[model samples]
Target chain A: MIPHDEGNGTSKPHAPRIGVVFGHPSRQYAPGEELVVRYDVEGVELPAIRAMERTVVWYTEGKGEEDLGVHRFERIDDLAGLAEALPHGTITACLPASPLSYEGVIVKIRWCVRIRLFFVAGRDFVSEHVFEIGAIAPARGVVERVQ
Target chain B: MRLPPFFGKKRGHRRTGSQAWGSFGEAVFYAALVAAGLCFAGLLLTGAVGIGPESAAPGWMRGWLWIFIWLIPGALLAFGVAGVARTVRDWGKSEERRAAAEGLGTLLESMGQSPAAQHPFPGVPACDDLVNSPGTILRYRLPIESPESWTLVGMGLFAGLWNAVLVVLAVSAGIDIASGRIEWVLLAVLVPFVLIGVTGIVIFIRRLVLTTAVGTTQLEICDHPLLPESSYDVLLAQSGSGMLRSLVLTLEIEEMASFRQGTDTRTERVIVWRDIVKEWTNLEITPGVRFETHVTVAIPAGAMHSFGSGHNAVRWRLVVRGQPERWPGFVRVFPVVVHPAPPAESAAVRHGATADGVPG
Candidate 1:
């Protein structure tokens, strides 16, 4: 199904029937803004999971080796209960000011909320939802931040 | 087809007489310094007091040699004293003279020989057609054929022929090794050729495939002036002749950052967001004809506007890839500028245009 047009409305579906979404409806966020990440799980019968971790990472993609800066990581509720019933949870992370999301001819910087669900099988289910993080809008002049 | 003047002209260089004269004078001055040092060394040795043996030495000849050596020292002293006096006099000059001297030094420091600025070399300017051409509002068409396109064609032919030769040689070597007719040392020699053959074959196939579908890609943004959050019609026009087995068009915004390492500057391209705007199979176009299509893409709000400077840049491009059966795929990237979203009031007016005023 075609996702909604809102930047924040974009969602990614993962293995084990998991869906991830961002709480804020827009993908574009100002620096220092709180990133609210929402996750939902379907079905309860599954292998015993070890842990669920959600990380906010800013990364580069394209033309060169990928580089990532982990901004936040928080363990979520136990995965066992989510399998018994439909599970829903949200994680809030405060964003930092740097490495503002950028796009260029040879390089692109992206900010995404990555969710990883670890299973005892040593395999992890990972999914990410990308969003834009920019500086606060200026009144008239352009904001020039050098990194 | 005639290419734009910007791309047609080749850079020309001419060595000027002044440059040659300057170099000659510098060489002469340095030679003179060397000669002076050599003369001083000879004077030092000739002026030495010892003769092989006092009895075997001619006293008159020694005396004459001493006189000549003494004259050499006198000349050196006179030159040194003159140079010191001239330097002291120059140092006592007025402020104006000092300023003039400083300005001359700066000018010489700043002077450098580089490619003449008058010629507009292709590459950046060629890719910046959208900005250079003012009338390119909705549709920006590439002017004539680019040297890059020709290069692809040439490289394809060269690689293809070379690969064929390598393949023949490799097969012969392989048969020899398989039949145990060649020495083990021959295997070692054949390994490198086989590796090169395989690499050449891949490059040859890739280049040929690209050449088969080589064409210019043009981009047309639906909105006269693109605005954020609003869906705008994105148009792609591919000009070429052939049947494409699988073709895909991708729209992406990427941010690029450049840093310097030693003397080389490297750039990194990170895709902010990308989507396959269109995909097709068995698409056919008239030979030597233009084919155009329109798709819709929303410029996500909060995305940075196009940026460029010395060290960093952000760019938006419509990338099209075409794959033909048994042929290598080719990609064409068209640069587009996403101007800052118009003011809210202006956007409203643009959207408020009468239905009749809108083009079909």
Candidate 2:
């Protein structure tokens, strides 16, 4: 549930929103295992041009210089779903043997699935949601809500 | 290219730390120089020209005395000067002598050279004073543990008190001279005081310079989850003000092996792979300028991927060192992760391609 607006109660403008979720809601996977990704685009004009792409990458966020590695990139173009539709489908791909996510005093490695929407007039938006790969997996699925 | 593991059991190089023998040798050599200078001054003060009154000595004896007096002081002065010159020429040349001479050599080189050429940032002037140096501003300091710690502790107190005493004596002498109560002959007696004051001032300046001359560096990689046999771009940057004698960037992949030692578990870091990625020498940096370079590092295809569990792991890191001419150099490490290359696909097994020829 969204929190109540601050005092004075002037609501902010509604902007386009997109949501992404894994098929199994699993935040962890192993090498050579197939996993599915699902996406939802909402709150925008119907028949809007968009591209849905899947990417596997590792990145750093602290201390030393930031680094990134792209493991996979697959794009689905002409995503012509209606505004009320969730536009959800299963995307299957095998995981590559990789640097497991790690956190250290001077370094941090994060793995994530990022969706970027490119619109006219240079109004491109990017959102990154992190996941895990390797033997270490969380005990429960992490539920991420879309606005 | 596929290669064996870069991590190994042997240590690669000695980067920092003091050596006992080198320090002792330096102390002895410096003492010898001081002794020679003092002896030469002593001989001159005792009247090196004529041993006695004009008629009190034979002509041959007087000539011999003149030779002894001049020869002793001349030989001593020559020895001291030659020793200093040799030291300057051989500065930071050997590994064994590297640590002890590291601080002094850098400090002297920066003090001697003019300001660095280009600024790191545009429109900002280079630093002309140590107090406003870039290195000092970029790096954090801990109390009493810096490279100059020992030198400061050794001479700081004595130099401060000695300078104070010299100031007091000079002021008193000046008052007496202005009042016309002191003889000009007594003014000659201040020569020893002047020498002592000079020594105190030099030591005090050295302590200040050393305290302000330490440098810091950083490394940024363009990509992470690095793949074997893939080239990754990297940026190396260093911060310091003054003359930089050398800067070296090294990429090291170490194997962290864990084993049972008696009842305890022990982990040992062995550097199995090492490479010198880049080096820059004879650079001058001002306050607005920093040392930065771009380089690429390739991971071997056969190299092991980074792994971590309850017991063992393999790790990779980039090490950057900045050796300033007259200040303390620094070494910084940036850790990285390596991933194994994906398995090659077979001829007929296309996973996601449809008849329309589009990727899923």
Candidate 3:
């Protein structure tokens, strides 16, 4: 469905609403279980990692494997704080970055979430729904904003 | 006129990945050029913002050197990328076709004719493959365009960067001499780069012409002959594609000696390959695009007495078909030899009729 409202009970007139979804949980992740961080970003469709639980160790790209950022999400405050810091159109659930808690479960996994943004159409005479990323299978977590 | 659909309504060219070497290497080459442009821009801006007047004389001399260093490499990168992308795109289209041919299988068989074929909205060419490739669903491909213009543009960008760097070097040197800035001393060493850029600009112009592929149909002697008897070396070399399989290949020979003894040379004949040239090939890549073809013919040489140089004589003839437009269904023929081959013996035995003693 085309979601028009952000997760925090807010909506913008011109902006497209963003949402994420996890797959039917496929295989196991690296050292820890997979963690998927989603954001129902409105009026814009972009994704980026705002913060991590620990200092950045390393990241790489390969087939059947993706190394996302390692972040500690101790409380909800850290998640919201980092989310607000990121540029609107850059960070999203589908992007390579995510927020994590220090005391809570470590969120370090690639997103299998397909974030689609729905915006009001202009002269095109059709509502615009764009997938922020291609097919992704999120292993865990709810849709939360980086801020 | 459209040829018969024997080869099927040929879709746009597809990549067979059959290209063992294509724009892929050139892609890397262009990407590296983009990087070089960025690096040169950075260096130019640095030299332009140099420290002041105290170091004018030394700084001025150094600035010229940096301009040369920065200009040539940067320009080469620009032209290489600009020109390479166009050629690569053409090649990729060929590969894409290859991918589609096998990818669609029987479903693609009745494209324009079958009722089950996936047809786009009102368009030309009757059929369209737009399910996977959203782009170019309805457009005629213009074959007359060339990407050489991009090379010239890239050269222009490189020139601007070089000039910018030169000015920066000049300004920074003047500033350092007047203000006696110590850090500005580092800026003076860039004079040589300026010189290289000037020289590079000229070299790049020559290189661009050498590399571009103009769609010209040129076939020349394989090698230049030092003597009248040049071993009859002939090879057909061209850099463009789009020749049809049924094309009438005409090879005109002009040399000291020529002879055909066996099927080796005659089979390969100076004729266009009717089966191999225009292929609807595809198999996860462009079909094998290259084939190493060669043929050797035994040329009968005269006693070397007819010609003044006691050398053999080979004449050249231009071959043309009567029906030029009705391509493919054609024939290949050579100029008549001055002396004809001996008449063949009749196979039919003279059982009834005789020449003189028997019944007529």
Top candidate, metric lDDT = 1
lDDT of each: 0.55, 0.52, 0.31
Sorted on lDDT, best first, the list reads 1, 2, 3
User: Per-candidate interface C-alpha RMSD?
Assistant: 21.6, 21.1, 36.3
**lDDT at residue B285 of model 1 (Cα atoms):** 71
* Deviating ranges (above 4 Å) for candidate 2: A1-147, B1-212, B258-266, B345-360
Which residue runs does candidate 3 get wrong by more than 4 Å? Answer: A1-147, B1-141, B144-152, B178-184, B208-360
What lDDT, from 0 to 1, does candidate 3 have? 0.31
Specify the poorest-scoring 10-residue window by lDDT in model 3 chain B.
B302-311
Per-residue lDDT of model 3, residues B36-121, tens digit only: 77776776677653333555557667677566666765786778778667665565232223323433563455475656554321
The DockQ of each candidate is 0.04, 0.02, 0.01
Residue-level lDDT tens digits of model 1 in B1-360: 222122222111111122223334555554555467457757567745333345454889877766676576456556655554544555423222333454456446545635453212110112445534432445434233233466666766766676687678667777987887876675686677667767766766666566645566766663433434556565667666777787788766655666665788776556655667789888777877777776765555545556444345566666777776655677667666555543222234245221111110
Residue-by-residue lDDT tens digits, candidate 2, B247-356: 77776655444456678765555565566877889878777677777676666544445554333344666766667776666555556655554545222212221112
TM-scores of chain A across the candidates, in order, are 0.70, 0.67, 0.20
Q: Which candidate, 1 or 2, would have the higher DockQ against the true structure?
A: 1
- List per-model TM-scores for chain B: 0.44, 0.37, 0.22
**lDDT score at residue B68, model 3, on the 0-100 scale:** 67
lDDT per residue (tens digit) for residues A1-147 in model 3:
233222112234544444433322332222223334333444432233322111112111111122222222121115465455323322222222111111111111122222322122211001112222112122122222111
